[model samples]
Target: MNSPLTIGVFDSGFGGLTVLRALLPLIPGARYLYLGDTARLPYGSKSRETIARYALSSGRFLLEQGAEHLVVACNTATALALEDLKADLPIPVTGVIAPGAAAAQAVGAAGHVLVLATTATVQSGAYTRALEARGLAATEKACPLLVPLVEEGWLEATPETIAVTAEVLRIYLAEAMAEAPQATSLLLGCTHYPLLKPLIEETLRRLDYPLRLIDSADATAQAVAGQIGTRAAVGVATSTAFYATDSIEKFQRLGSRFLGQVLPPVSLIDLGG
Candidate 1:
């Protein structure tokens, strides 16, 4: 209903900041309402029904805050609850999986694409189906522990984290090799995975297989931009704001890790309201 438009970005925690960073630059004048459900984060391990309820509450809160559009930036939530939330919300809603899937298809076909996401996302098989729909082979692996490791700010070194990452990667690589010998691309299916790119790259190098990594944040940003149209002039206030279901301090601190800077002040809102 507004001219410049305010985009609502929802995440289980800090990960959505990655999506926000990409979308902000693309739509310069567009304001954004970033809602991080940090109090009840790590949606990856949650049940589908729980995730759907949380996502719906988050979307509804954004709508009440005057959001023009919604971006479900959490892969777990997107994988488990996007469709139901979209049906419940009045505004247009977009999720991260389709954009990532589409980007994987654009990279190439025939070669296998390995998807690294949370357990729930992998369990949903959204990436596999989306890629198969485009005639590409996809292999999905769930790195369930990665989310906690990331939330702890151990992107580089944590022996246990490193061990878990290595083991999970080894399994994915072995599976990919067995299924499709030509797999050359890896999709960072979860928004939080990009933060561990350096460690992941190191692991791949040690394995002697250099695979191209796709950041779903970039794809989802592009999708949001395309949906909202081109950028407008700077200084024109778009209706963007920030909201969180829990601690604003924790959200701001961790969010900077993803977005590369401290985000604008975030307001706390109880979605149950």
Candidate 2:
């Protein structure tokens, strides 16, 4: 019998749970190890160097856990450190950006696409370049606060969060629309941003902009399936294990919110080595 194929997934915080949620259903019968660096959450505000260092440590930790493949699920880490991590790691590694960019371009609409993500991701201009590479112009805005808001477990009908999200969306949408009236597609660039999608859609509705929201989670999952060549039969694990560098309680709490269910037993691991 073949050994079960295991995939390792890492994120700066709870955001990557969004990707894992989408992936598990798509590729059932696969073993997964998810690590959330909740201790050092919010890679968005950190410097490129710091983000890279943290991501490397997390990725290495996953590798040590016997991961056959690596998925960098955090947009900030994908933007700033994926390449370096890929080079350093022995297994095939993937990031969410390329799949997302490919999906956005496949829309093929001649309009500005807006990307909302972390400051680190936005500053890297990764999404902008990815879109433009496929001949689609993109406008990216960094919503550094939204992640924290989502982590706080505020998902619905919060006036304060809605107002803040609206304000941020307004700035980006206004700029994109002014530059091109055809701008109609908005990509949720960060994994965490999907949690706020309802509020964002409502806000856009008020602004009279009929925007199509694109989430890279599904696309990223498909990409992983392709990379791993899903023909390899793997054992179906009913419960996926979780690991965190920080508070397992916080990870479980935020992860459940993102995944829409309570996460299974999450163990704490020290990746500081």
Candidate 3:
């Protein structure tokens, strides 16, 4: 591995920016290439074949950009196409689910863990199986509404909107806790959920639950950094390139929230529908 590693992070949409955000601080000065397949997003609803097709295309594009390592930031892609990617690409490929599960295990929590993700991810049972592999039981809930709400910028901290988001969290958490009362850790299964971490913590606080929160994006980033094994900032500056399959303006606008900083002009990439 080089001092400034060239890593490619791919997601179906902007949610994966959180993973990149975590990576920026951990691997500063590293050149990063990110692709968001906005045109064929919601990989969750698509079939495994369609998802593998779309994800593999994105992975190949990143490799063409000279990426030495690939990070599949989308959980759906990790669930359905991770092996496909590793088999097709020569680079070391990593996905979010395994690292997320490993993080929960590292915390050494007793009882079960709760996973919150998209319907597709929950249906895939990837997180459930990963956690079970580490000797933990998990209950997964698909929080379908949270993704759209986060993209809509509904978390403006205004009383009304805040209440709405919190209420939604309350409802989801209440239901999830009821089904798995022994769950001591809450694994945020979606990359987008990191944006709602505060609200989720507050909601649980109000609910009188002391569940440990795990952000998959953070866990994935840590795993990637550990794989590279460089903590010291080595280079002068970090470089990043952004590509999106559709709606460059929307991706650039909303992506900043997940990236934790403003994004440079995004290149419009057409990965054929």
Candidate 4:
């Protein structure tokens, strides 16, 4: 393949932009198409069948836009619907969970590993399964509030928002620490969590929880780079496109926070219920 690659990234909402942000630096030569299924988000509340149906539709839509490779950036989708998408989507696909678990194993070295993710992702026990496969002991806590706070742009907002977010993290991490007393690493199992890494690390310090933080978004981007070697020409501009199933206005407004740059105009596309 002499030409640049076109990779499609899908998420339930804006959090996936963290994955795309990580990808830009690692694989900048390639074109990127990101779709956030905003209409039917919070996939954690849905059943497995519903998740698979929604994810399949998004994957097919990306392929329709000429995506040669795919990245499943949403933790809930990766936990519940990855296999379904893999079986049906022909492109080489990667997800955040496996790389995240592997990252834990590599860093934890048999020490207890703790994961902070969405309620649906934790319920699926995907991280537990992946970590255990590598002979690592794992504890997962569903900090359901983290995703919402991240999406709301509260991480760096006003004093009240900052304090509230910090308090929430303190509560979740404290509870998780009590359960996984020996846990030595904290995997930011949600893509959005990466944005709060500094706050999380500070909170861990305050609580004396000596766990290294690993952002799965970064891990996934590294995996993608390994699979698709650096191919950007020395001086060619990269192409990026954004789409959402609902609320294009919100996607563009909140998405800039995830992408670290003003998002290009995001087009609205329906993937159906």
Candidate 1 lDDT, tens digit per residue, 87-106? 99989999999999888888
TM-score of each: 0.89, 0.91, 0.96, 0.97
Overall lDDT per candidate, in order of appearance: 0.82, 0.82, 0.92, 0.90
True-vs-predicted CA distance for residue 187, candidate 3, Å:
0.3
Residue 242 displacement (Å), model 4: 0.2
lDDT of 4 by residue, 1-273 (tens): 357789999999999999999899898778899999999998888999999999999999999999999999999999999999999988998999999888777775456789999888999999999988999888999998988888887888899999999999999999999899988888888988988999999999999887888889999998888898887755666889999999999999999988899998999998878
- The candidate maximizing TM-score is 4
In candidate 3, what are the lDDT values of residues 90-186, reduced to their tens digit?
Answer: 9999999999999999998685899999999999999999999999999999999898889888887477887888888899999999999989999
> Candidate 2: where is the Cα deviation over 4 Å?
157-181, 232-235
Between prediction 2 and prediction 3, which has the larger TM-score? 3
Q: Answer with 2 or 4, whichever has the higher TM-score.
A: 4
Which of the two candidates, 1 or 3, achieves a greater lDDT against the reference?
A: 3
- Report the number of clashing residue pairs per model: 3, 0, 0, 0
TM-score of 1: 0.89
Q: Give candidate 3's TM-score.
A: 0.96
